[model samples]
Target: MVSTSTLTYSPHHLNAIVRGSGFPILCLHGHPGHGASMSVFTDHLNPRFQTIAPDLRGYGSSRTRDRFQMTDHLRDIEALLDRLQVDRFLLLGWSLGGILAMELALRHPDRVTGLMLVASAARPRGSHPPISWQDLAFTGVSGIINRVVPSWQWNIETFGRRSLFRYLIQQHTPLAYQYLADSGMSAYLQTSGPARNALNAALTAGYNRLSSLEQITCPSLVMAGEADRHITADSSRETAHHLKNSQFICYPNTAHLFPWEIPAQVLGDIDHWIDRHPQVVASSEVSSQ
Candidate 1:
């Protein structure tokens, strides 16, 4: 029944997708990606649990001024949940969204019944690898060439457009490329340049949350791609270590886009974990703000 609008305005006026009817699963997309970008996971997870995927401010149709900070993003999530009347539920985050998930779990200790981090890290300042300058130069050159030349391709710009989304998927897999292109490219490219810049700055501002993870004593799940270049698997493994109650899984031959790369398996794992917790207070609680 994977039917979802994945668009339109929430009561709070944020752009989001709400689907299915069961225990809630609030999905937070990574940087440069919108609610639709999470369709791969939400579509699968929705069969059992309701999924709430929202386009964070400054991205997709939730356009706002270019300037926004971590606080603003957090407020957006809080307000959206408040409007939705979600009392407690599981939270899932991918990449940058995962970091926000950690912060939010800490903020709403009672609201987040469980936490799931996909290809994410708590201390992103040091955990996630920085994109090299060479990538930037190539994306710019490719964008120029795309204006004139044809077929020859390169990435690194705004990801999913004339950008580096290819690098996120498992390399050399044509189906992976086409899958992401068809399902997520449009939303990824909709990112405003200034908003993208703002997100970039926030990521590099030396933000770290490792020491504070102990406070989030919720049942947590950390899934990582063994081949992820953006965020190392070891870092993800360590993120699980910080949580007093957490499990870590690494998939071989998968990269940063494992949710899209291996949707079925990922969903199975997520389902199994959620079944064990069932939002019981004694089971644990934890996500993105």
Candidate 2:
């Protein structure tokens, strides 16, 4: 069973959900996604590992602020870990969350034992051409509109939300779309305009660690879908190339929503990877040693 709780971090609060037991793994969701986005991992990973998924500030149940900076987001993760007394553990990040995981590993290597980056890019936007036209429309046009529109005006119209959701669903495979729709993820994707703007700014501001990828020393597993329109497979390959010890895998006939489209395959791969890298352990063990 998954347990939900709120952790107060002075001025703001983070909603977190935890499940299973054993090695602790912090799961970070993508932009416009909350802790529940990673909840699927719990269903497949439980009994072997404890999954801790939290809503990032300004998203889901987490408190929102006027401004959402990368530094602030980083602090929130740290604060959540401190509150949970988790000194070290593996980190799994999907899409935007993958970038955050890389940042955390770069900034605090000791705190991260390993990294699992799923359908994420190391370079900032515009670093390379988008893989498809749908990618361009979604990131270039819709992204701008979301940033410019007022929060009150955004998602207020049923037609607008439905249209956007439809487009988003169209990007995924039929199986993936079905899973997302059944999980009520379509509603969750309707984020406030301000939050969307904040995320867009963070992503496009060009403050990235692509150049510093060689600095990451931890073992990493980079997975990407060959058909992912949002982030190209080349990005994942580049990321793996830079990491001292890393593996890259591309799912054939899969897209950005591979987590939902191919949950069993993804989970199995992750579990096998973890088994090969058995050094990843609980925080208490590291402290005891």
Candidate 3:
């Protein structure tokens, strides 16, 4: 729930929200999302875990002077971690942030105590896959609504950015999941269009780390929404298969923005997962949870 402090870090000025006082937990948001989106996850964790939610380089309030790569973001997080003197911590990421978390754990396995990936995957578009008839059924009426007279298209074109930002945060979630639409407006609006495009380009441009995921040996928790249009639950299952020590969970009747859909459950799951991994150990020595 913190995130007011904005500090200038290397590559770009990194604004972050550091709250609570316990084992550190660094949270990262998805593409076109800022650090604030992580508030849904970090808000309650403050009492049990120290949460560091930083706006990634070229994201949110961070300045996007030029096109940035995936590596640039990793460096920013590393620098911020170093600056804060956080030697080791748990990592939680959603969507694009999950990809980065995997990369970070691979690059520095010793530093990441554990990992929590929500509605995300190990690969790029492979995470989303192709929407099947079953998924279409899960989408139900919302799919028809969007296809016929999408709120996003209309808001962006006619209502201007103010309206567009609100819908974009919802990400076309069905009516049942649109209750928190207003809460996410600040996150989508702060991020620039170039930042979103760059992140998309980065994901689509040969961004596959499925093969390399086996190199990471940290305790990992992977969760996905059952009806997530952007990233499918099956893709998340595939990701868990590649990991040596990982647990996977798929929430029914949920979408890409599942955390917002059910905040209490998300927090409970995270707490239970973190409690299981008090000490980081290699997969060879312990069984996957």
Candidate 4:
């Protein structure tokens, strides 16, 4: 079962969802998403392994100010884990969350038993293709609108009271779309405009992990969707290549939203990776004594 609560950490208060028990796994969601966005994976893994998902500052139920930086996000995660009493465990990051996970692994490899990156790259927006004129125009307009209007009002005007199921699940097969709807992911798309803007700025700032990738010594898994437009499979391959110890997998016909599009497969792959690393470590520790 999933339980929800809030944790106050300094200037921010993060909303978190926790489920199951035993070995812990901290799940991080992507941009324009919150902690609940990992529900599909967490629901499947619960009871077998404890999963803690928190909405990053400036997103979801997390409280934030006008601006949010990458460093602040990293600090929030560290404080959250400390408060939760999680000394070390696997770290699973999807999309932007993956970058944060890599940052954590790089900064504190000893605290990360294993790492999983889904549809993510080493650099900010590294896998994304060149922006088209239409995309640029859309962005310009959105930025102006976001700056002018309040987040809740703008969200209501643009998406109305209905869910964002249709607007986000594009390019995927009909079956995938239906599956996402069935999974109750519409709510996951709800986020404040400031949060969205913060993420956009962070991406535009051109953060890269190319030089630091070699420093990550933890066992890592990188999964990419072959058809992902935002983060291409090549980026995932590149990231894995830089890692000293890592495994990479690319799923054909899968897009950026593979976690929701192909939940079972993604979950299984993650489970296998965790079993091979952290679980193996636990077994060896027992045997050694």
Report how far off residue 194 is in candidate 4 (Å).
2.6
Could you tell me how far off, in angstroms, the CA of residue 96 lies in candidate 2 after the best superposition?
Answer: 0.6
Candidate 3 lDDT by residue in tens digits, 187-254: 55577765676666665666667888888887899998877767777888889889889999888766
Which parts of model 4 are misplaced by more than 4 Å?
Answer: 1-11, 126-175, 178-189, 279-289
Clashing pairs in 1: 101-287, 101-288, 105-287, 113-285, 156-163, 156-164
**Tens-digit lDDT string for candidate 4 (189-267):** 4566767766676667676778888888878899988777777788888999999999999987676777766777888
Q: Candidate 2, clashing residue pairs?
A: none
lDDT computed for candidate 1 = 0.73
- What candidate 3 gets wrong by more than 4 Å, as runs, is 1-10, 126-182, 280-289
lDDT of 1 by residue, 57-154 (tens): 77788887545555566777888888888777788999878987898898888777778999999865223345667656655554444434333333
Model 2, 100-164: lDDT tens digits are: 89988987887788999988878733233325655544444433443344222332232223333
Most accurate candidate by lDDT: 1
TM match of model 3 to true structure = 0.76
Best candidate, TM-score-wise? 1
User: In model 4, which residue pairs have backbone atoms overlapping below 3 Å?
Assistant: none
